[model samples]
Target: MIHSLVFLNGFEREITVGNALVTSYFKCGCSSFGRQVFDEMLERNVVTWTAIISGLSQNELFEDSLRLFLKMRHGMVEPNFLTYLSSLMACSGLQALGEGRQIHGLVWKLGIQSDLCIESALMDMYSKCGSLEDAWRIFESAVELDEVSMTVILVGFAQNGFEEEAIQFFVKMVKAGTEVDPNMVSAVLGVFGVDTSLGLGKQIHSLVIKRSFGSNRFVGNGLINMYSKCGELQDSIKVFSKMPQRNSVSWNSMIAAFARHGDGFRALQLYEEMRQEGVEPTDVTFLSLLHACSHGGLVDKGMEFLKSMTEVFRISPRTEHYACVVDMLGRAGLLNEAKTFIEGLPMKPDVLICQALLGACSIHGNTEVGKYAAEQLFLLEPDNPVPHVLLANIYSSEGRWKERAWTIKRMKEIGVVKETGMSWIEIDKKVHSFVVEDKMHPQAVIIYGVLAGLFRLMKDEGYKPDKRFILYYLDQDVKHN
Candidate 1:
């Protein structure tokens, strides 16, 4: 109708008609048409300038957006808060930290930092550019920080590994009588979950319950994750059950938690329950289920689930899914089948797939497959020590000492050394970690004395220490030491 009106009215109303067309094109995401209409406009106002700037930024033409900002200034149109906000966003998307700093200078010159929207946009820009320090400075300088500003700061801290700092700020926010929203709790709990601090996680759990935020799905999901990572599978299940509504994340969390605990049957049960509840499983959910099947040696079940993923769920299998299938087959001692499956994958095999085959070969004493896996793994990860060690072990087990020596020599020439494995256990909420023969702990002498006594007791009980458990480089004297 507007186009018809323009045609009926002819060139006398070209500017009016052109502006309408430009606005319509911009709204419909036809930026090229918008640009054409904009170019034909006889006179453009600040609104016209802003429309183009916003349209370019929205389309992610960040460089063009910045160029248009310069053009707006040259045309003597002063930028308002909206203009500055859009430009700052463009700078952030482009990761133009230097340009962002220049924009910050402009904000200061224009005295618009106190403008809430403009300041928030600046904070977002700095944070997104990986400059959290600048983000915090802007946040602190603000006379009145809103929920949006607080969320941004908390997110910045979380992303930067300042978990404790973020939690502290969250506590202060509550103390200041700020209303705690679901988003705030979710953000804080997310950091707690990643830290894997059970005590801290429990404290957050109690707070969520006290604040009556348990019903929030985001909060519930975070609680599930925290409990899972903290090794409290039962607690995770309890929290999951209490959720008023469950999404794919809640189901996946429970599934993965069971897998982590080596309760494959329980994990499978939960997967079935999740399906019965009509929650669609994502790729992550399937990955967790497949991992459980692998660990439990449920080869047929794993293959059935893999088939159902594409046929029943309509989710396309990614490389990760293929890797999981290969790992499952390999772990179950189906070496040839695993190799064939990997070869048939539409995607090229990765080092992890090769390493999985190598691990299986090591277990089955399949020298042929072990040698093949080792060569491929070595090419992919030349600096890693596992493939070399596995190959050398296979040679040593087969009485091929010369071959073992050559493998060790090659490892040394490449400067690859097997990393010593350490085990840790938490007692009284403090973690204690030790490697074999490590004597650095304050109670190392007492621990060694106790271990010697246990060894003697075990020997008297007709138990023998598996010599294979000892490092090859260690002799009798070193073992005693």
Candidate 2:
């Protein structure tokens, strides 16, 4: 009607009307019309460019968004903060860091990088592009730190595998009296990823309720993830039952919660209920289902799920799904079957798949398969010491000290350092971390005394430590010394 009225009124060429048309076309998912309106306009301004660029971005046409933004740059029109933000969003979605950096240079030249939104977007783009150092630089140099920027940087840390730092940053935010917004709440919950962080997660849940984000579906989903990750299945179930609305993630997270808690049958039940409720299952949903089957030792169920994932859902199996199947077979002591499955895969086994098989082989003392897995791992991850260590453990378990020594010797020759084991205890809302044999804590003496007592009890209960693996430790000690 507007198009007709504008034509009737002969206001089609007017700047305001043309801008509206471009924006409206893109907003309505008519990129062709939006482009037609844009191209036909005799004159275009920053708003015109921003409308088309940002509109394309909002529609997830990231490539077109960047292209249009580039076109705008080549023209006489100068992009403002809004245009830069849209381009940044496109870059982030595509992880087009090189293009994003060029845009950053332009924004810096315009002297608008100090703007909070611009800073946050830039940081987000950098973080998503795997440039956490750049993101950190932006965060540190920001003129002011608001909760939104803080949240972005926090998520950046988490996404970049800096979960420990993310948690510490949250602690700093809380101490600084920064209000934990819903987004911040979710990010913090994500970084509280293991059962040890259950205390932290509960505290955040209370905050979520107080802030009235309990009803917010996004926050509700985060709460489910937090509870499930922290091994609070009952809490996750309670949260799921109370959700006002459930998205695909909500259902998937709940299914994964059951999978993680070893209730594979219930995970299957949740999946059926998700289907009954008319929610489409995503790739993650199937991954969760497969994980449930693996842990529940339902081999037939797992294979059926894997088949159904491709045949029924048409979802291509990811490397993780294959890894799950391998882990399942390994757990069930079907070493030969797992080996055959891996061999039949069209793609080369990734480190995840190899690691799973190697771990299983170690448990069952399958030296032959273990050696093959270790060889694959050696080719795949030349630097990762986990395969070397696990393979050596397997050798030691099989009474092959010479082979175990050879494995340790190979590690030394390759300069592959074993990753240090870390442990932590949360007391009085403070997480205290320790390394292997760490004696730096104030209560080191008492801690060691308690550990000694526990060791005696464990030994009495036939829970003896395999001192056979001491070869690797001895080498490690000598290397470090």
- In order, the Cα lDDT scores of the candidates are 0.81, 0.89
Tens digit per residue, CA lDDT, model 1, 59-165:
88789888898888777778887888889989978888998998889989988888888778888788888899999998988998787888878888888778879
Top of the candidates by TM-score: 2
Candidate 2 error regions (>4 Å): 1-45, 144-146, 461-481
- For 284-376, candidate 2 gives per-residue lDDT tens digits of 998999899999999999999899889998989999999999999999999999999999998999999999999999888899999999999
Residue 387 of model 1 has an lDDT of 89
RMSD of each: 5.5, 4.2
Q: Lowest summed lDDT over 10 consecutive residues: which window, candidate 2?
A: 472-481
Q: How far out, in Å, is residue 397 in model 1?
A: 4.6
TM-score of each: 0.73, 0.87
The global Cα lDDT (0 to 1) of model 1 is 0.81
lDDT of 2 at 204: 79
Model 1 regions more than 4 Å off: 1-185, 191-195, 393-401, 417-420, 458-481
The true-versus-predicted C-alpha distance at residue 432 of model 2, in Å, is: 3.9
